[model samples]
Target: MAEKAKVYFTDFRCPSWRENLPQKLARLMMTAGFGDIEMEGKYVAVKMHFGEPGNLAFLRHNWARVVVDLVKSQGGKPFLTDCNTLYVGGRKNALDHIESAYLNGFNPYATGCHILIGDGLKGTDEVEVPVEGGEYVTAAKIGRAIMDADVFVSLTHFKGHEQAGMGGCLKNIGMGCGSRAGKMEMHSAGKPYVKEKKCVGCHACAKICAHGAPVIENGKCAIDQNKCVGCGRCLGVCPKDAIEAANDEAPDILNKKIAEYTKAVVAGRPCFHVSLVQDISPNCDCHGENDAPIAPDIGMFASFDPVALDQACADAVAAQKPLPGSVLFDKDSGCDCGRDDLLYANHPDTDWKVCVEHGEKIGIGTRQYELVKI
Candidate 1:
């Protein structure tokens, strides 16, 4: 029926250790058509998540150097980039974000490129890019620096997500590229609220909130939804971990929105996606800590179509045996039998397929892919 997209793959087998994993990744990307793009003197955004401070599941800085060196060889002006997080964490502002990246070893000396916090300091600098044929977001508030890039490349850490089920290429490009406001828009249908028990009467939330959404009374703060613009700044500034997102949106809708956001990021640009399906962690890299991997390490995958790349990765993970002591192995062994969908089996509340289906339906990419092992 439809033409299948080509997804290049490579196992983690390094015959002599001289070639190394980074070299293998570079070779895989080239095989997947990375060199086909005209990159001479063009601004290329290498989007990826710099693992949160203590998380060890993110792609190493050495892996990033390989991509950076490749882009430089092609005369592309490449920069490592990612927008601020929506949740309260170590990466809400550019300063803290860079610190976190450096803490996680994403420094220039390590990655062979400078890091650019896409949304600027305070995560307020953004460009509203129109999403063509979008059912959810008409205009996505993307980081100005990301939108300024002539080419977009996603270097994703393919792992499990509590919400998206699996954070693959689509999740990396879509949700990872969104600005603070954009992330807020995709995350929940309503504003955040303060938990009374967790609130310490600290005016920290009130101090950070521009709209005065957090009003303190009797040492307890309440968020006024009418006044709150859902910027998600308070969530990060709260010292007591009192503020939390409503998370009111349906999982399917959230997945579709992620696809729409991804379309916005890569729509008019030359885009390439690379996913390292290793570390097979049971949660997103955004977490401060990572649990043991759910499955054994798969390998690297690269594709022009993120949807195709993600599908190929999903298939690869499905073919693997779950790690005996990991979360998947311990979670209801009954369902694990004959269940190919380990991601869903790990988190039954979320359906990872929704994102890819919406991606295909929205012309992001095709799910049918030819997995070409390099």
Candidate 2:
């Protein structure tokens, strides 16, 4: 297939890309036909995740400032936003979610825009929109903020994922758009029991359990498997890490959910994507604590096609030698300097390819692409 996405990789290592990323991204949008947006005075939602507090590997606000300014220059009102998380963490509610964004330097003062949590105060605020995916029918419960936007642009931090292999355009749009309940669906596909010894109870997990799986018996949350819906929501809400997304079918189900959500986000809106390949962490930034990066800082990529952008970004990452201090370099390195670990040699257990293939099959974009370096 011909290349449908154009991914430009830039990094802090090269001061030019860092200094010029904003301008580059701005022009990229126009060059890629964002300027042709038919509606005037349209609201352009810049979908971005403000990394959970304590996680330092988030996309820089400076980059966002440039993009937002450019959008305004083009007469598009741009706002940076993300939906509340299903887990009972820093971002479970709008208040906590906004606080986390502010803590992460996304305050309105910094980015010249508002940081609106997709779901409102309780995370139950949603606007269901119809889509043609199997798992979903009537509509996806999208954050009202995201559904209200006239157009969508995803600014993603590309990195390794503990569940879906890697987080990229599709993950950003799909999982990111989900309201707390939407998140419930994606995570609920599998259920893992809590180890009795690991359970400090604390009732944290029990509180978020939509089902009465966890009950506080003598000040400890005891999960009743029969009542549990397998939402996996309780697992992440537990501060002690007692609950976990079981290895059952969570991975595949999560991927499918991600694709369906992406389709929902861009159903009618003209959407564009930019995936930063730098600081390729071994796990998603969803972690309260970000581990050391697994891959060295690569570059930035922008594309209208989520699939091609992901494929190009993956190819670029595979082509580089692991950084000396990073986790990937610590593993035995036999792959070519210019070829990434496509088979995930370092991570024999995880496979990032499934999402790309599934996305292609579902028509998210094309895995077949021509890499264009600018």
- lDDT by residue for model 1 over 1-374, one digit each (tens)? 88999999899999895898888999998888899999999999999999999899999998889999999999999999999987778897889999999999999988888999998887778899999889999998899999999999999999889999899999998898888788888988888888899999889888988888889999899998889988777876677778887878888899999999999999977999999999999899999999999888888999999999999998787666668889777764524544667887777888899999999999999999998998
lDDT of 1 at 215: 90
Q: Model 1, stretches more than 4 Å misplaced?
A: 196-221, 233-243, 332-339
Output the number of the TM-score-best candidate. Answer: 1
TM-score of each: 0.92, 0.82
Q: What is the TM-score of candidate 2?
A: 0.82
Model 2, 194-221: lDDT tens digits are 6666678688876777777887766555
